[model samples]
Target: MTGKKKHSEGEIETVAPAAMGTAEWQAEFLTQRRLDKARISARFAGKTLDNFSARDKGRKMLVHSAQTYVSGFNLNKEAGGFPVYPKGLLMTGPVGCGKSHLATAILRGVIEKGYSGLYYNSPDLLRDIRATFQPDSDLTEDDLLEEVTTVDLLVFDDVGAENATGFVLDRFYLIINERYEGCKPIIVTTNLNLEELENRLGKRILSRMLEMCEIFGPFPEEDWRRRNLR
Candidate 1:
């Protein structure tokens, strides 16, 4: 029997008779869930570790580390066989340095391993939380917080881009602290340097993040976008 499946990009795929009721079928279902819950954007929909450019030594190392992290990921615990709290990756780099691409690729890998994952652009997440206050909105703040905190993996992209108001700070603290307390894994990407991130997110959140994640890079400042333009 043949079946049609609609992919995240709205493309249709023919599921062969051999794939039906098999591991591939299950994986397809999980992929649908990943596309919906992860909320990866169209621009990044095509990004995968295989396609990420790693021509330079620094970028090659970054890609290798990402691949290792994904391969070693465990749904019940941290990556790399750590029996302690679930550790994650903190990818710090300049804008256009491919941090988000790598972050999304990691999230995709984790989800494909039968674990649930979510990807949220930090500012967009805060904006959604704020929208919950509107009378017409369908979701509550707790609902959103619970979704992020309970996911098997969470990719929080552009960590310091949101405005640092008290409200924003409190919400961010709650999300990070809950995940930290739960020993859940989180992948964070940001352009901010250590000092700048500390200033933006405050010591409390930064401390928790430092404890929860392994630092990846202060990647070279060469902008891929600029290179593409040249």
Candidate 2:
């Protein structure tokens, strides 16, 4: 079996594999293909760290934080000779402080390094989830939940930017809770401070985040957005 059969070298094998006709196999193949495409697309998408400027002092600090996160990251690191999960980062500050820029940078870098990552503007994510309830929509609630929960790293930008209604809060909590319990990392950028996040998302969710993330920033005095206004 180690060597090719000399007699068969001239023959062309044309039979289809039996799996080709199986619906389960076909669906799995398509799902894997779509995931592969998504990973490639994410690597090329805009707002990545490379494009984010480090000119301003505040932006530089944000960049430094992101760099530190990426540099120190080792998905397979061991603790006390036992494999351990990595903690994520939580970026919270006022608007215009390069939070999203840094978060996206980290996200893109992780994806390119062979880890799955996703960036979602918090409000837009909620809106998309709501849209899926339309009569003609294809994605179920569980499907969206699974995607958010399973990504290796998730950049949840603008965490409290949306109106924190009961339904939105519930959906958001589900994703956060699942990821937290599963030891998955989530990079979150919020316009709200910890107190405000606790107020909006409640103490339980905030506590889970405290356990899972290293909190960074409230660089309240830094407004890079205003510096670029033309």
For 27-74, candidate 2 gives per-residue lDDT tens digits of 666555444544323433566666778776766776777777887766
User: Model 2 segments beyond 4 Å from truth?
Assistant: 1-44, 55-58, 218-220, 228-230
- Give per-residue lDDT, candidate 1, residue 51: 96
| lDDT (0 to 1) per candidate | 0.88, 0.76
- Relative to the true structure, candidate 1 reaches a TM of 0.88
Cα lDDT tens digits, model 1, 1-230, are: 58788888979998867767787787788787777778889888889999997888888998888889998887555457766555898989989888999999888888888788989999999889989999998999899899999998999999999889999999989999999988898999998988999999999999999999999875778888899676
User: Lowest lDDT 10-mer window, candidate 2?
Assistant: 35-44
